[model samples]
Target: MTKFILTAFNPANGQRARLHYDNATSELTSESGESLVQAVEVVARANAPAVSKQTPLAKSSPRVLKISLGLSCNYACEYCSQRFVPRADETNPGDVQAFVDGLDSWVTSPPEKVEFWGGEPLVYIKTMRPLAEAIRSKFPNAELSVITNGSLLNDEINDWLDRMGFSVGISHDGPGQPVRGPDPLQDPEQRAAIMALYARLAPQRRISFNAMVNRENASRAAIQRFFIELTGDPAVPIGEGSFVDAYDEGGIAHSLRPGELHAYRNLAFHEIRTGQAANVQAVSSKTASFVNSIRSRRPASSLGQKCGMDKTESIAVDLRGNVLTCQNVSAASTAPNGQPHHIGHVSDLAAVKLNTATHWSKRENCPSCPMLQICQGSCMFLEGPLWDRSCDNAFSDAVPIFAAGIEFLTGLVPFHIEGELRDDRKDIFGFSEQVKPSRDRPPRVFPIPVVAA
Candidate 1:
């Protein structure tokens, strides 16, 4: 329940002001002659929806089903989370028919969305094709999606993808393609396939060039420009803009360095505020969610893992019916917490026990973190230096959103944060070194009465 005083510049008047923020309740109040607490409370009461409770794990059904094709890939992305994960025995097309047959008995209703996962899903096209076809036959209307690195796509594959009504995500790190591996764009065959698929799907709002932020490719504006130029569209939808989660030595090397934190935050914040990165979902969606959360007074308890793997209805399975903690980890792998990533087999859903993950409530820092609403809790099972580095990257990555969220709601650009939180995270955008806001002004006589949570 650490409450902190935050300093900012109100853009409207160019006057510096202070605001009190409660980490425990997410309450914000102006220390200027005016107050924001009353307005916040009023908005909270009027807009807050009844909390949407998560379905219990034991009684859950698949609403969003993610089928991991396997860990096999065509390219080696340096920071890919699954790059070094211990892979389970491969499941081939031979298992597809049985897996599809098993679905009818367990999956009572067609899942709203069915995602096919891969290191590069196209690597398993032989298996993927039959499996996808079977699922489509069973649930013709389910929103089928697949993510690929775009190296193996061709006219035949593109035609199959379009006919299947699948929404595709070409996982390309536009400006930083070299670091990810060989550039598929340079290969004429690969280039044509990618462009053809993009042309077909972009028109239907069914494709995105999912990009990740890393030390080498940190600029959202740059990433946006690269995609816009490649797609010949100024409004390309960019997904997965948040910083990467370090899973191995390569991932660790790609993560944000300690010295680069402030610079990255500044650039990210400026790009977001100036609208240069508006097409990126990570920025726009989060800003909207933060504003809405403020209006609704969304409690931190309602938050879940950023990946949604914690939700009972959001299930990830392999062809063998082995349920996993997430798509990133395989059934043969184990979480840092020493629990097997394999929660249970889909054949026995009632016997499933998801003991691999720890809720954010168990983490001492999350409840009081200002970024909890935005980050939720990254990589639920991450621990040791991986967790620390991931948390650090998450904080710097979120600082811009925090500033933008506050600015959008209050017309104030936060420059410095003074609170009971970490010493390093206290200053926002170097405001602590700047001139202090006037505390000499007479305190307003009318105090906004504190609202109980």
Candidate 2:
């Protein structure tokens, strides 16, 4: 029988829920199934438990590590949650080495995958190269990826990436006039550069676009059309969708106008339902099923519910070797007393403790929200000055607006109706049929050379 393991890491409770599966029988049964809450409970129990016990569970290796190289970024997007920028004097080799060493030791057995992230990873390519090389040498089996802006990509970087079998996730805001800041490149030039990279590297490497939806771009139907056109190719991976909420200078949540908010929600929902968006295609069948199951348990008011930073599979580390509990918060807040915390230099393999209690909590307030299952208590950093507090008002207000928009968009695409309405007979989101056609659709032609695999 094919065996599968499912583990749920609850940072809030500092506990895990693990399930072992028998694929042949399509059943989840554990060695301690009778005593476990669910089949996956076995896997969770293998990690930390929600409740304390005399004999602690064996620690399981993390399945993925999201290493945040630093807070430095090239763009100053208005809605940026972390508010990161390249700090000229902040990049330290000692700190990078410490974190690398810790990761090497922590993952001696290694996880299923590892991803490198940054304000812009290319900025520190020199520092990152050696580490990437080391990881490749140590864990040949690990799936490696880098989340970058793609502005600094060149032949040399591309060659390195090809050799490492690295997957690339490029962050761009479709063809809407630059809302985040000045265009990284001027009009035609910018588009050309982006397309060039896509053509040269996409076939050989797994590449996808992450587009943040906001008011300026979402308001323009042309922008959405441009997105569809840009990523429509079968060979070229397309857009990955994410919501960008406007924030005030103090980092407090700012209210979005009902219409603007509605537009953003509509676009995201439309993309998911129609399979017009990018990364949606790449989401695993199992993970998609899990998300749909959670959605079915909630009412219409919580469509975008469990979608946030915490549910993500990666963790963030900074230039100073500080391991951030969550990347959504500013660097200062991620550290103790709002000061940066360092794990160790890149060369030392030491375990580090995160004071998660301060930034994460699951309270009564959360259970009452209709989107609780989907949202899982919202962004940890957005809860309050201390992470433990609940953002009750924010949760209640945002759910309905988002849900309405999602529903409206899904309605526009007839194919998704059965899936959205929870008809068991239909495949989840009608994914099997819709996604393949959408992906096979012809892409708009561009001048760049399509990279050969």
Candidate 3:
């Protein structure tokens, strides 16, 4: 039951207040000991579930089954998580049937959501088609989804995806597509195919343009504006608007440096409050969850990894029937923590032991950090400097949402959180003076190329 003292101000009148917060109970109170929030009608999240490398979670039938087709992408995006991970033997069309035939053996019931993964899923379209069709036939009611670079989409593939009830996510870095070595958008045929696929899926509300926030391209508002203008839909949804995890050197290069945190948080907070990043899921969902946490007294212990891969009900696998820690790695690869990516095989579901990843509760600073609820301790499997960089990036990314959620419920903007954290993280924004801004100032914007033709 750790608690922290907070300094907050009303942006409306510049009136200041001191508050108390209990992380375990999600209780916020005024300095006089009056509760500021009433718990909403929901089950209490008293303690976070503890799963670690030593005390691991086991896999059975997954509610969300992620099938990793292989790690063979056409375009190498700069900070791709799967880019440097060791690849297993490439999955092919011939391997699909045996894999599908074996599903019922371990998957006790149909998953609520089934996702096809890839270095690029479209790279093995032949294998993907049969695998997806078989799964769709078996679990017609399950939600089907995929994230693609959109370089290989053609009329037939797009039509097939549409017919299969897929929630398609096209991965693009908005103006920063240059980080992705080849510019498929520059090619007429590839660009046309992407648009065709988007057009085919947009009406059903199953399509999203997924973009990641890197140091060079760090504006959720700009990313939102780019997609909205590109699709000509004011309500176009944006996915993966959060900071990228540092998987390797490329990732660390793009990750937010310590010095840039304050300005980024200030800019992000400004954009979020101004409604510029309203279409972004990272902003909307994080803020809402924080508000709910305070209302529900959500304990730090009930939280899992941000991706939920730590849950027993979520499983990742490849065509050869090797169960993986998550869709991002292969059976042949090893986690940074010295555990094998191949946790177990599907044939022996009961023996599946996931020692590859650590949960948030097991990590340092997570149990004490104010952003614990919003950030969820970054990626579950990362370690060393990569983990540090990812954690830095996540802290900056979540600060704005934390400030916004507090302002929403208490009408007081959080400027500083006096807690067991680094001194720099205590400030919600760059301002150390604690004075309210006289007016909203726009953040600096990098010049972007006009819409891709």
Candidate 4:
């Protein structure tokens, strides 16, 4: 309900501008009451999709279907979200026939997107192949996608994926591969398979090498350079180039320390402004969206979480028909607050509930946070220390991009956000409000950014 005062400075000179941002109304205006938006649309706050412990989302005919193949993987990445989730019995190829048979009953109509998820999806290729094939036969035009570590990719699998028009995302940490375990790029067979798949799918713009940034791998510029060099493609699109959320001990260990936030944001902003990360999907997509939000004066009431899983029409389920809060979790697991991840069964769509999550608006911080438009709150189900650490990482990670979006639209880089937020989050890019943008320059040159949930 409170409007935030943003302290911004034009890099051309030491001139400053004060802009007021209203989170609830999503209006941005200057000192003279000139709205950043040429026109503003006032939507009722009652329209906001608010979910809490008692008010959980209910699933029905879904437009976005996420099918969890299983919580099994070949490589145990240091910060994998599924690493600790209690696994149900492993789904096998035997379950696909029955899953496919029941899909029509619950699906009702053709889904817009059908994404296959796994601890590493290809780990369940046998089950995935049949499941995806059946879904494809039923809804050929639906967008089929999967993300993997690329260790299991082969010529046969690549060909099948290409024929099916699947959008494949290889999850590699680029230079941060050491911390993620074995590097597929280092293995001759895996490298060849990955590159071959890339060559086949790049023509259709269906492949992207996804990377995650953490305290250990904070530089998107470095990550971008690494992928471009490895792939020999100047414009290779990078996916998920955002900071990691702390799901467990490994995630917390890899999260940015309190002391590192300023430096990280500075480097990130420097890279973004210089176009070093222009090809990063997260950077391009998020910056553009943030800018549009300003132009439209997008109200927080219309916003959803970073992940669309909170919507009633966006549902995730396992092979056995167990509905989940999201793809990263398993039905056999329990959320940190003791809520069951297995909220319901797909057979009874009307009975399915998403109680494991709390919507962004339900959280005390999100409604007043400066980065609400871009962050929407880190992970809907995460709680306690994990949520705190994840929120910390997300704040520092978003500040630079938030600044970039403001700089693009108003020619003023935001240095501080004055609002009812944590004191440390006020000074963006770790520069005091008194400092000019030109004087508070990044130590190194070159860049580009993404907004992840």
Candidate 1: clashing pairs of residues? none
- Candidates ranked, most accurate by TM-score first: 3, 4, 1, 2
Per-candidate TM-score against the hidden true structure: 0.91, 0.60, 0.94, 0.94
Cα lDDT tens digits for candidate 2, 1-453: 133343222223323334443322223333365322122221211211211112111222356666666657776666565573223245544565655566654455666677776667787787788878877877788899887776777667877887788888777666743666556545565556666666666777477665554445543234445555775654344444333433334223323343343333444444443444324332222224333433332222222223222222334555554455544443455332343333223233234333332211233444333333333444433324322212422332233223332223221111111211113212212232433223244422221111111
Model 3 lDDT-worst window of ten: 444-453
Off by over 4 Å in 4: 40-46, 433-453
Candidate 4 residue-wise lDDT at 110: 91
Who is ahead in TM-score, 1 or 4? 4
Candidate 3 structure lDDT = 0.84
- Supply the TM-score for candidate 1: 0.91
Which candidate, 2 or 4, has the higher lDDT? 4
- Estimate the lDDT of model 2: 0.44
Q: Which residue runs of candidate 2 sit more than 4 Å off their true CA positions?
A: 1-61, 84-89, 92-104, 185-193, 219-224, 231-240, 245-255, 258-291, 294-315, 327-351, 356-364, 385-453
Looking at model 3, the pairs that clash are: 47-301, 47-302, 48-301, 48-302
Clashing residue pairs for model 4: 271-447, 271-448, 272-448, 275-447, 276-447, 277-447, 282-450, 283-449, 283-450
How does residue 204 of candidate 3 score in lDDT? Answer: 87
Error of 4 at 301 (Å): 0.6
